[model samples]
Target: MNNNNNSICNKSVHKKNVQHPLLINFGENQDGDGFDEFILDTFRFVGGRRYHNVSSSKYFLPNDLPEMDRLEKQHYLFLHIWRNNFSAPVREKIITKRKSSLHMAFEYPSAIFIGVDISPIFPSEQKKPDNATFLQNMLDGLPFEDDTFDFVYQRSLASAISEDQWKNDVIYELHRVTKPDGWIELMEPEFLFSKETDAPNCHKFSRALLGFLATLGINGFISSQLENILTSTKLFKNIHCEERSTPIGQWGGRLGEMMCNDYIESAEACKPALSQFIGISHEKFDSMLENIRMEINQNRLYYKTRRFYAQKA
Candidate 1:
């Protein structure tokens, strides 16, 4: 929030001409390509825009940036640590059976990738590949029909929904849209960390952030309760959960460096809300974030991530 702080709040509205592997844009149809046309049509039919009216501020994170790149990096980081998109065995089934036509149309041999976000961060004019498609949508009420997808997964979306919505709407809708015996997974961070030695400023900022989120009806520790939430739904079976801890700075290697940057970005993204709710100044908030970064670079800090998955029965 500091004047010198990288304008993290500045929204990127212009579409960049640059192309990345993760950018998926399905442009108008060209002649003599029936299959590609069919796929694009299907993607359009299935992807809905029920939440288009919702403001991006409701998401509790900065969505005005090129999040596609951040998501691509985050996806690879998970793959690097877990070696797969999921820990549940149903992931293999979803990959092998090809039961979901929506999943197959985007990718011939590989699993189809479809992303929906409330922000217009993805490309909208370029010709997208068959492997993936991105849409603007909301999590609370997905536009898909009941039992439509083979695997339903939500990651780092804890801040997007309130506690009541998570309990009454988000979980139910995710379960409702998943096919019988399909899988639903949630991966989120607790946003709580520790350092080898006492770092008062960093701890103070972290606590303040957690408290701020709580006022919005978001549980900063929701990741730890994911297993219980899934089990209590009575709509899933074979529930499983896993946790991984990684260093934040040079001590954690290249991956750690990336994670450190991720943490910093998250903090910066939440600055506006923190400032408004906690009455903290932009300069003080920026200083606290810098101190946290310093702790990470000093190899004194580490954080944990939790992943939970279950099968819809």
Candidate 2:
């Protein structure tokens, strides 16, 4: 990401203090590609995991390799549940002739891609294909001009962006960039299982998660509520929304097992942040997670996920 023309934009200036030598310090180069430098801080260790160093970001989970693996497993669970590589309906709306896309699903020979993320989670310039370009920028402030894309797709960011940001900043930015009649799709999983769960610890985790999100002014049910949220915005019409339930224990078979791991891993990742939020020690948090893991298997736990695909008015 050190290339002169790289698109990882800088939003917040990071402190130079490193608690561990293994901490990643992606030095900034503002002149490269006219995009600001974006620093991904995973080296700052806390509660035995890593998290973003950006003070303005409200993401509650860790950003280390283990967390990525957990997310990948969750992605696999989605593929298994939907029996497709993606949840959006882009076949006729896109992937036909040559098209310019931001965060597209297909790499059709004629299609060009510009991906945006808060971190350099994608392949570097030397490793990525020529058709794909990436930019590291905060979601609230996109670098593109208005009417810049034929399609825009964002997934799994319900935690990273708050309700206020969605209602006031992020959605408007998306509306501003999307061309009229173009498609915009977003997928967010409730991804939390504190409600309607039979397990005691899972209940505790749920209440804690709700309290944490409330403290940050984020909506806990954005997954199911996003369809109405988008409709209320008045920027888009013809909204297509879908919700799915996934099993979280052995009762759901292999899919359930994977879902179970996704649940526990996510809760565990929040240990560093949420434990403090609820005034608990690291050891007590671990005990709670262990009980949650076993209780889910015995209780037939399940959780809901939702996605919305809409078009600009």
Candidate 3:
């Protein structure tokens, strides 16, 4: 990364204080070096996981439902709750050099207005808009070259990556694809049982969910440690972190209701796995979730989501 170039870009953009428009292109680069073919191969080999684990399902709440529209609405609500319009400044520097095209990649493409995903659970019968393209591919082994994109963004992937993969493969891969002085943002939620605060049943549910995920070699609390994890790489600079509490029920207003719905749907989706690994019966699990919902409505328990971003140097 050129320090002088970055400093110039920063000064120019900060002076304007305008959000930069992102330019995203999903297809192969001008090089045409089998990047598209590699994406196809990855999708074929890395089929989506079968068991709907809670830890993973949080990334895509209501994972079992095939309704694309509802899922998209849920995602938009989530973004609104987190104040997506607050715009990270690092992205402005990346956008200043490009055209006004924006492309986003998602695991489930149906719900999003544009861009593509590895696969769509509910394939849309309607024609896709010109701005949207759907591609099937996995995150761990992206097909793009080093510095292919100006900005890279991923959210709620803690369940998809294990602790080892996070430290070794995932972070490095993200760094490799980002342009020098460009930005990458990761958003994730920490799942921990509330202790000594009067939410015992909710805590028990949280404990069981975390314990079950541990059997699969995933760390449920990884979100809380992301700052340390990314800083250790020493491959990035100007790292920024932000956290917000997501209220679960009506007490938290519209955002709370949406978050509560996400949590409920996430728990419901993981019912089968919870029953199998933790010996939690369907009836018992449903009852417990109801109690948790009540607790959320009463403002007794909440979960926190962390957003981290940095400039690759």
By lDDT, who's the top model here?
2
Q: Rank candidates, TM-score, best first.
A: 2, 1, 3
Clashing residue pairs for model 2: 4-32, 5-33, 10-36, 10-37, 23-43
- TM-scores for all predictions: 0.74, 0.80, 0.70
- Given candidate 3, what's the lDDT at residue 71? 46
- Which of candidates 1 and 2 reaches a greater lDDT? 2
Clash-forming residue pairs, model 3: 118-136
Model 2 TM-score on a 0 to 1 scale? 0.80
Where does model 2 exceed 4 Å of error? 1-43, 85-87, 96-107, 191-197
Give the Cα lDDT of each candidate: 0.57, 0.61, 0.53
lDDT of 1 by residue, 1-313 (tens): 0000011123322221111111111111111122343343322221121112344234555433233345556656766766665555653444533222232333443545554555344443344445555544443355445665666666776665567666766777767656788777777876767664476666776788778878777787787887888888888899889988877778889999998887787677667777667687878888878988887787557778888878888
- For model 2 the local lDDT of residue 60 reads 59
Residue 232 CA displacement from its true place in model 3, Å: 0.8
Poorest 10 consecutive residues by lDDT, candidate 2: 17-26
**Model 1 stretches with alpha carbons more than 4 Å out:** 1-57, 66-68, 96-112, 195-197
lDDT for model 1, please.
0.57
